[model samples]
Target chain A: MRTERIGDRGDLHRLAAQGLLYRTGPFVIRLQTRLREVTDTFARIYLGTEVLEDPRLAHFSVRVTASSPLRRPWGAQSQFWIDDIPPFEPYPRTHAFPLLEWGINWCIGTRAHRYLLLHAGALERGGRALLLPAMPGSGKSTLSTALAFRGWRFLSDEFGVILPGAATVAPLPRAIPLKNRSIQVIRDFAPEAVMGPVFEKTRKGDVAHVRPPHDSLARQLENAAPGWIVFPCFRAGGTTAVRTLPRSEAFTRLAQNSFNYRLLGERGFLDLTALVRACACFSLDFSDLDQAVAVIEDLASSA
Target chain B: MSSHESAALTAWRQPTSVRRFTAEQWTDALWGAGQHRCLARLSYRIEDAGCANACPEPAWDLLTSARYYPNFLQVRVAREIRHLHRILRARGIDFVLLKGGAYLSAGFPFARGRGMNDLDLMVRRSALGEAEAALRAAGLVTATLNDYDQHYYRTWMHEIPPLHHPERGVEVDVHHRILPLTSRLNPAPEIMWADAVALPATPGVAILSPPDMLLHTATHLFYDGAILDGFRDLLDIDSLIATHAIAPDYWSRLLGRAASLELGRPLYYALYFARRILATPIPTATMEEAHARFAPGALVRPVMEHLVTRVLPPRPRAARAAPVSAWLLYLRSHWLRMPPGLLARHLGRKGLRRFASDSPAADWPPP
Candidate 1:
């Protein structure tokens, strides 16, 4: 099922240009593209990721193809497709990397109903998983990436995927995308980490992707048990504090933030109830990344 | 036809045909079945054949997930029906469920994990206004449509514009008749209501009786000319026949119902395509009798056979003839519903509107 990353740059571009099969945490994706921007960015970010040997069964297939030349005179545009159907409109030709990233996320969130998917950033410590679920402007992504760089094994900075009724969370780590002000915060906070180029004026303001730790991809298949659930809210100049949340409140908030909670029905409810009941739930309000990590570190070690 | 594309149908028709599928074969089957919107049905057949556990990773996950989803929606659909049932019953209005909702509530095994776009119900034409008012009062919101569309539906179409229950996220299509009022044939609603049966569990909620159910499925499939979803519609017809075949005199009752309602043409096409495409079982006598009574003229029969043969396969990719078939089918459907002058006027207006393209893709964070 595995082979070393498809040789060097030429081979990578050649295969992906036609079409190539790559494994992404339990699901196999077949990507086809010819654009240099897409191929180059994909190579850099996915260097640690494996491209599968032949005899493949892909859960979803994507093709990032250029849109009509005339549609955008000043800048070329590219559209994302699964099979032959376009799920979203075209993105700037330069911004194809994040388009690919979030396109895969959309497919997983929409189609992968086998697991309960929480809209949370997940990291693992001491064989247990930490989930940071929050609504927009909650500083979850910035905080999760901060934790990952500080020796917490990264699972994902997006989907916290748990198999229904299982105690462990599956690893689906990818490049953590830091948007707007969080981009600069992460750059200053984690100077040692590898980062990708930032594309300006994306739908969500400026965006850049931080390559996950090498160990995260190496142990992508590993699963961790439930340890903590933290809902992080970033408030500039505010004090860093962690308050315990009742399991019931955690379940409700988690479901509201979940990608497919309603779609999974009873199984989602049961699986989530079990996870929340087994874990320590908290709402963290922090302005300083260092203090936030410290508090979460204490909770992780306690579990 | 590609051998890969045939895997799902062959497996569905004969579950034991292939016990294990190679990765490539699985990809082909997945693509084919997905195009038909029969992934859940395919999954059920695989599980029933006892091969689901033996299947490789991701394949099993994909199947179980697709199948489980409809069951989840099934719960929501039932709740929505109950909500609608109470609303209409309190206002002393009687209604019967139309398609998926009826099939689900009527205890048909084929409907177990079937995914549907919207829940459909039909109230008496006399009570349409009152039912609409009661539904609006009950907090079912209809999306804002333009004044022209509002007039078009209320004046010409059999159904009002769809109503969405904001809380449950379910769309309800309240239809007053089986076909459009302007259609070539208006199957009497009173004849249908005579045989409606209250769901055993939901006393006030009702579904069409078996013969009428078969007739409705046939009429909706052929007259609606839903060629894009034709493959799944064929599966529904096949399953309905298979389920009802167990009952004594079922085929004759269905034929008699179609004849009395002047809907024999659609019933004949439904049986013809179901048998040809899905290999649905139809008694020899029944097929012969239907052909004699309702089959099209000699010239048109072969033409239709050519088109449906092209349109109804779950082809891995659409064949060259697909668009031609779909175009003809689209026109046929409109012609079946409206007189020629009205049809032309309606199509011209709708075509003009397409000069302005469809709404843009939804913003991210939602998808």
Candidate 2:
């Protein structure tokens, strides 16, 4: 089906007034945001993703709006609401775009328990995806974005969504948020990358997003089997080091890095164990994005 | 009063009512279920009614997501129970699982989609210290409530202030009895424990016997706590009755158990509301006997009936509860749980603390 791709400012505002049903791979989001920055950033970064004119289902209905004047004056604060429930206090209005991204992530992390969600960035090559599971500020997003430009299909920069009881990985393929130094770092590294306006002083420091590769966004529905699990860390001025992670340690670390590991219980154990067994696990520490991409490419060839 | 409400109530009572639901009515039913926090149960009901295929894709999707969390919690609850039993059994302490824990452990149909925030268990009053110690030794700490709050819980409440497991991230409520010690009605722990039934599959854990379960659910719903969005508990009563009321002597035994536990009034309200609202099947004779023997005074009964109609159903997000009715119900709940003097002291202290510690203007949207 040919779906609308939210393009014009007037259309964006009109849809925001009425809820916009936006599809992101397996999940559908009904989003409403009056904030121009949010809508504008979404239009730029979410290009090529289908916007269902009228979707049959939306997993989440979310809104990002200004806080009451009594609490904070207009344009000073914004609240992220899901089904009228605000999970967190309001963020500054300037941070509306990032707040919406984080809020949508929160909804998926909490509600989409049907999939075993790993807090990882994923990219596919040769029909198998390499999962980069790491903590925040470990440069997962930066590495994922770098690889997406290096001929790897970006599955997701935020989540490695594994279908239940399957080693196959589904692509969320949303925009890769570039945080703080990574914003300028990505700009310098991939000059061709479409970057959104940077929102200064977000909760995560200066934040902007890189538009997902058009090819990856076009093939968002594509799924890949597990090929390798690479736990990567970016260290300043450090020699590039790659070590084979033990299966047991990989299992434990993967569980820890999962969003719904405990919630999935034995199912999580089975899936993670299967994933660890099926994949070649490694821990890579690199100082250079080019070197990191080189190491990952070398690892992918063997897979 | 609205057809949306009527449709929801009708669908809840007889799942076949789903066949007649228009798009708006179906959405309303979903909203009602979500508002009452029973969407999971509704999913089960829809499937049972064979309306799963008939329902809109969005409703089923929402239901699937709703059921997902509860299923997730169910597995965790089982693991937590197993761990707790391993610890408590070493001390020779046998505990009765309460509420959601009991429902899940006992494998009730209603347990399928029930979301649980914590695991509640009642040990013998004499063993309270030992159980608390056991939990503490296992690395669960009591919440760092203020001195006044701690004092109040220890002094008057049936359960200690909630305990938190730092690693597991689950709350555990340890109760030594059912009702407040100083309340006008004290349902003895012995009576409940005496009739409690052991979960066959989950050995070493027990739940209140069928009749005592209903009474305790009733007492908790109508007497023990703030009834904020408690329509779910009321559904528990209806489901329990629907499942167990088929036994030849269920109603008689329920009434007898309620009397023995000094929970006749709660049981009466439970039966009244369950039948009046959800159309739960109760023997006419039992309802009449409960009405005659345990009904409130004429003036009080009329007022309660009015307020209950307002408060029992799920309210729309935009609609406020009838403020006066809600406040009166709140006072009644407190009065039933605590004596007059203690109630005043407790409410006054808590009110003042709330006023003083009010979040810096930003906490405008209270959960």
Candidate 3:
């Protein structure tokens, strides 16, 4: 069967208003919106994603729209709704696309307990996954985007979606959001990267999105087993350093970084423990994006 | 509302019927149950009915993920109760578990996936002061500190303002009665206390008798609960009857208890809708007797049926508000809760506050 990819911006608008279901790894996200910012950016970023024609189960049916049906010209705000329930306050109207991205991520972090959702950036090579689990502002997204340009299949820049029992991860390669300084840093790092309009003064400061390589988005369903876990940190004007981590420490850190570790209870513990035990672990700190990418690539090859 | 999902909601009581559902229909089942906050319970039914394989992989993933939520709630309830138990035990006071907490403590199998946002327990009115002091000393903050809220809970409401456990994020509601004291129908708490059943597993904890439990469920559904969105409460009534009404004498006992408690009206509504909507097995004799004894007057019956049936079925996503009937039912619930004069003053104050803040959707939108 031929897969139906999204067409032009006008075509995207119609499908979204009528409710468009698109596959992103294990999730069938039903997205509906009239906000041009959302539809416009979504069309550009999701070029290779499969849009399901049949009306079926969607993990979330979300709509991005103005707070009120009647728009305010001077200071309009856009809200994100799952079904009819708006989970958060609205953002500035100009920030609709970013709000849509964050809104869907919120749905996954809060509800998708079918997998062990690690708060990490993941990329695959030779059917083996390298996990870059880190806290926010630690250069996880920047490094993952850099790696994708360097021939690694991007799994996700926000989530390491590990299916329990099989201990394998399916791809969740949504757009990689580059915040603050990471924006210019990625442009310099990957000159040919496809980028979206940057919204000024978001909660996380100036933000833009870089679509993952077309190759990664095309092979989103290919699953990979955990082969390495690297906790990365970025510090300006500092030298590169790498240190191996013990299994026990890795297990604790990974669990702490999970979105639903406690909610999954015993099952989460077992999945995390098995993942840590099966993979080699390390912590890498680098001042340079190029150096950080090189160290990760070396680790990927050695593993 | 006439979509496949709305149609799927009609078969919610029969899990075996899931076998006939296509992948799309299973998706519909998930949305309705999720909207009602009954996903975990439906998951159990799917498994129990031996129809797990019939559920599509997509729907099954969500149902499986939903398991951890109620499981998390069960754990939180147990921890919070343990904290309360130690404090109240030091004061030589016992609390009667109500609703979700009661079902959980009693080990009811159907309660496995039930979600409880707050802990509900009842104590004698005299012990209210002592219970408040103990909880404060235990470091559970009183979330309702504003003068109006405090007055509302202390002076007239059935439960005092909720006490928040800062660590677990669970609030506790300590009740002296099932309905507001100022409400039109105030069942005697001492009478319920006389028949509370003690649990050996958790000493000093007891649940309402089965008959009282049914009536309480009915009253809570129609009288106190948020109107137009009591599908879960209806499911509770069905589950309660299925579990406890096995004995031949249960119906007679339930109806008799409703009379003694002056709760016949709520019970009539409960049984009427439970039968019509879910096809719950109510003995024909009980239905006839209930209608004769407690059915609403002719004028009110059609109005209530019109409003309730419209609201109970899940509305399609496009319709934002319930018909004007919603505001009417909401106002009716308040009217049922307190005398008209007091309700007028209270709603007047609240209406002004809503106008002030520009209602951000809601602080609580159903479940």
Task: State the local distance difference test value for candidate 1.
Answer: 0.83
B1-367, model 1: which lDDT tens digit per residue?
Answer: 3463456677677665545667766776777777677888878877777877766776777777787678877888888988998898898888899888988878788886688778999998899999999999999999988887898899988899999879888899999898888988779999998889987776666888888888888888788656545777788888888887899989899899899889899889988888887789998899999999999999999998987877677764433336767667767777888999988897777766665655442221111
Superior by DockQ: candidate 2 or candidate 3: 3
Each candidate's fnat: 0.72, 0.38, 0.77
Would you list the C-alpha lDDT of every candidate in the order shown? 0.83, 0.83, 0.85
Better of 1 and 3 by DockQ: 3
Off by over 4 Å in 1: A6-10, A68-74, B1-6, B145-147, B164-169, B318-321, B351-367
**Quick one: best DockQ, which candidate?**
3
Over the stretch B20-41, how does candidate 2's per-residue lDDT look in tens digits? Answer: 6665566556666776778888
Candidates 1 and 2: which is better by DockQ?
Answer: 1
lDDT for position A214 in model 3: 88
Model 3 Cα lDDT, one tens digit per residue, B177-281: 999989899799988999899988767889999999989989998998555678878888999999999977899999998998899999999999889777899
Residue B43 lDDT, candidate 1, scale 0-100? 81
lDDT of 1 by residue, A1-303 (tens): 345674444677788887888877767889999887777777777775777766777888889988777866777888899867889988988888889898999999988999899999999987989999988779988988998889899898888899878597998988788898998898899998787888899888898888888899889998999989999999999999889998899999999989888888778889989999989999999999999999998877775
Candidate 2 lDDT over A1-303, as tens digits, reads 555676733478778767788778777788987787788888888865667765344667789998777866656888999877789988887788888989999988987777889999999988998999999989999999999999999999889998877579999988788988888888989999998888888778888888998988889888999999999899989999999989999988999899988877678888888888889999999989999999998988875
Error of 2 at B140 (Å): 5.8
